[model samples]
Target: MQTSTETETFGFIVNDISRLIRAEMDRRTTEAGLGLTTGEGRVLLNVRRFGPTRQNLLAERLGVEAMTLSGLVDRLESKGYVERQPDPADRRAKLVTLTDEGEAVVCGMEPITAAIRADAARGIDPDDWQLLLAVLKVARNNLMAARAEAQSAESAAA
Candidate 1:
């Protein structure tokens, strides 16, 4: 069995790196005056990518609680970044869609995102960076699958 110190050396490095990267992005986003917290930006990006989606589904996609997502949606709605409309097919549900300002904010994020990516990739060979990204993608997918399996087991047991 791996000792705690051994686990920390590998698993913890990956976890810590993720946290650090997020922290850096949060700092840079705030400094850029994007008028968004990192969590808000994450919500906006998700909505932009798969919008016109129900609130519960969005919350699931973001791996956040429904109430937490609702709060974020409320803030974004007030800021004109997103609008929540009653789902035509399901009145009890609300769909989140990006507004014109939200689209503009997403567009403006391109440069900021590029700069951050460039900084993060600094000194790394392009090929190595590409490989690292590919590996991370698979790792993320594996983790997601594991979470889904666990959820399914819990649901079945219940």
Candidate 2:
């Protein structure tokens, strides 16, 4: 078993990277003229990241409630950055896609965002970054597996 000291190391380093990425993202996006709230930016990013996605799936991926995501989508739609269309798979479902303008913005932001990510990752050796990413990926899998096991156990207990 990993000692508590090892767990603390995992927690701190993971949290530090998460903070640096998020804070830098917030700063850079604000400079991009959208001045988007984190939620709004997340809505745009998720749309871009996963291609067209159902509104419910977007909410689930963002870990936000569907109703809250509804408001976020509403704001994004008003900005003309996203479009919601009926899902071809399910007529009642709405699929969100980036508008042409939104696509342009996303394209433009890509390099700038990359620069910020690179800056945040600066000072770390490339090999270290690779190793860190590998470790983080395993950490993510472990956490997800643990969560699934816990949920399954609770469901059976219930």
Candidate 3:
């Protein structure tokens, strides 16, 4: 019932790929016995990648609600995988950092993610892979800019 053109649109393809990748990550992480839900794994990896980020900023980056992130952080903290510390520059804001155990879990995740990347890139040439990454980066930046512009306009109109 679906036409090739409809399925080939940028939004359709990108969304489909994103869903598939998330599902694969969930399955792989479970099989690896990381004892994390996909959302928790994502939080850990993002924290490892960004390092000691403020909770609000981390929520924005992760495209999650602050309350949702708070719940996840609570669980991770209870598991001895992460800790929340008051931000030095903002007394009221909290920063999230991975505990040693979280770092260990992230280290364990690296190979699994690398394998997924390898599998996804299997048929692509090195140059094409680099090009694909570059293109996606540009697309992401453009979308972020658009969102910022809309937010600015909304604030100005208020």
Candidate 4:
């Protein structure tokens, strides 16, 4: 068995990589003049990905609090990047959608994102990159399952 000092742990390596990627994306987005905070950009991307999702659901997916997401949405909406509409299925809730302007911004972001991804994958074999993605997906799913189990247990206890 390898001692902690002898080898980097999986969590530490994964987290460091995540942090570096976020920092690089933040820098590139700023340099690109996207006029968006990292959180705001993430919100826009996720909104596009999920397609007119309810605000609460979007917040949950992003692992942020609803109120925090609301503020981000407000800023994006003010910038004409996103619009919040009454949720047809739930009158009390609002659904977030990317505006035409938002779509254009997302398009503008594409090159920056691609460049960052390429930089991160530099020197890694294509097969190894694919394997890394697969491993990360499995790890994410495992964590999600564990979270669900913990939540269920808490609900049962309560």
Each prediction's RMSD to truth: 2.5, 3.7, 2.5, 2.8
lDDT of 4 by residue, 61-108 (tens): 888999999999999999999999999888998999999999999999
**Where does candidate 1 stray beyond 4 Å?**
1-3, 6-11
Query: Over 4 Å off in model 3, which ranges?
Result: 1-5
Leading candidate by lDDT: 3
> Which candidate number maximizes TM-score?
3
Task: Decide which is better by TM-score, 2 or 3.
Answer: 3
- Name the lDDT value of residue 152 in candidate 3: 100
Backbone clashes for every candidate come to 0, 0, 0, 0
Each prediction's TM-score against the native?
A: 0.84, 0.80, 0.93, 0.90
Instruction: Report the lDDT tens digits of candidate 3 across residue range 16-60.
Output: 888887888899999999888878988999999999999999999
lDDT measured at residue 100 in model 1 versus the true structure, 0 to 100: 97
* Tens digit of per-residue lDDT, candidate 2, span 6-116: 645767876887677677777777888756777787788889999999999999888899999999989888889899999998999999999987887677678767897
* Whole-model Cα lDDT of every candidate shown, in order: 0.86, 0.84, 0.93, 0.91
User: Which residue pairs collide in model 2, if any?
Assistant: none
Clashing pairs in 1: none
Instruction: After the best TM-score superposition of candidate 1, give how far the Cα of residue 114 lies from its true spot, in angstroms.
Output: 1.5
